[model samples]
Target chain A: MSEVIVITSGKGGVGKTTTTANVGTGLAQLNKKVVLIDTDIGLRNLDVVMGLENRIVYNLVDVVEGNCRMKQALIKDKRYPNLSLLPSAQTRDKTAVSPEQMIKVIEELKEEYDYILLDCPAGIEQGFKNAIAGADRALVVTTPEVSAIRDADRIIGLLGANELKKVELIVNRLRMDMVKRGDMMNINDVTDILAIDLIGAVPDDEQIVISTNQGEPLVGSDCLAGKAFENICHRILGEDVPFLDLEIKTSIWDKIKEIFKKN
Target chain B: MSLMDLFKKKNSGDIAKDRLKLVLISDRANCSPDVMEMIKNDIIQVISKYMEIDAEGLDIQITQTESEGNNGNVPALYANIPIKDMKHTGPAR
Candidate 1:
């Protein structure tokens, strides 16, 4: 069965596009036909993130407005034959595509793909509404920060109000060292407030920046963040995958405690 | 300082969690403390007219509780109004 999932964070720069790209690529790597849709109409970046920016002949607006066929607008990735991207138009704003049009486009794509991932824009505006219009599930990505968690809480409430019951969470950019130092919110602290099923927890890694810059998703690599995204993909496919152990490095204080216990 | 406080200093994570707990409760309830106060006053006025109740001891709060069948947590409006006595009156007075 085909599943339409929207990857969204109510605040911007929280790795929504990155998560969509990696997870979509991860699913494709699993031999599933996947299509990633960039719904951040005016500020399109998924294409660039995927390193397919130059090949865009048509965009989402063109497909929805009947200017081009849906197949004509889908950009196939060179790395993964099963993975495709429906890039958003850079000139047009969010109002260019209505929620109904989004649903119509998704309904057609649903018949051809195994999974359709929508990269929703920030805020609960038109872009967000259109992104979730035809989605059967939602993956809310948030960082381990106060503002991000607050916005995520609001987004969860909005999704519930919109009748999207199958909602899960992805806590991204977690710094274990900071968490150990009590400077950052831990996974438990975040999930306690959000109260949603956690699909993945990606640690803050510098390799993500390099991979994203190169237009290559790090899912197939051995990087900690890449492994985390791959595990999330398996979990999304209904597999019982164990979460990555984001244990902080042992400190001198912990060593002292251990010595005392031994004594 | 207390021994517990010494062991567990108030960190940023603790502060964030506490703040989020309060904020989420209010956000889910869709009302501020002032609005809750107004609601409490209105409920007291309406209920006191019918029964002799302890107006000062009434407690009305929006709390999170488990729903039937253990579906999930839901925001519930709980009112604990103390009933002191009942007003005795003739019918159709």
Candidate 2:
């Protein structure tokens, strides 16, 4: 069965596009036909992130407006034959595509692909509404920060109000060292407040920056974030994959306690 | 700083969690703390018109609680208004 999932974060720059690209690629690597749609119309980046910016002959606006066939607009990734991208137009704004149009586009893709991942634009505006219109499930990506968590909570309420009940969370950019030091919010702290099923927790890794800059999905790399994304893909496919171990090493306090016990 | 002070200093994670707890409750209720206070006062005024109520012991809060069955957590408005005695047994004031 095909699943239309919208990857959204109420706030921008929280790795929505990166998550969409990596997860879609991960699914494709797992032999599933996947299409990643960039719904951030005016500020299109998914195409660039996927390194398909040069081959975009048609975009989402073109398909929705009936200016081009859906197949013609889909950019196939040479790396993963099963993976494709529907890039958004840079000239048009969010209002260019309505929710009904998005549903129509998604429905058509649903028949051809095993998974349809929509990279929703930031905020709960027209863009966000359009992204979630035809989605059967939502993957809310958030960082371990106060502002991001607050916005994510708002988005969760909005999704519930819209009747998108199959919502899960992805805690992105978690720094284990900072979490150990109590400087960053841990996974439990985030999930407790969000109160959604956690599908993945990706630690903050510098390798993600390198992979993203190279227009490669981190899932194929040996980086920690890449492994986490792959595990999330497996979990999405109904496999009972264990979460990545992000525990920090024993702290000085714990070491001192161990010494006292040995005395 | 003392070792105790270091432990006592609220970490950013705890601070974020506490702030999110408060904000999420208010956001779900679609009312601010001040608005909740106003609503509590209004409820008290209406109830106290006919009954001797323990206004001091009244409590009104927007809390998060899990729904019955497989449903997830939901925001709920809980009001605890204690009634001391009936001020008027008549039908109307």
Model 2, span A16-49: residue lDDT tens? 9999999999999999999999999999999988
What lDDT would candidate 1 get against the real structure? 0.92
* Maximum-TM-score candidate: 2
In model 2, state the lDDT of residue B70: 73
Q: lDDT values of the candidates?
A: 0.92, 0.91
Error of 2 at A244 (Å): 0.9
Tens digits of lDDT, candidate 1, B2-93? 88987778888788887787678878778988999999999977777777788899998877778998778777888999988777332332
Runs with alpha carbons beyond 4 Å of true place in candidate 1: A248-263, B1-8, B32-93
Total colliding residue pairs, candidate 2: 0
Candidate 2 regions off by >4 Å? A248-263, B1-3, B32-93
Model 2, position A16, has a per-residue lDDT of: 97
Q: For each candidate, what TM-score against the reference?
A: 0.81, 0.83
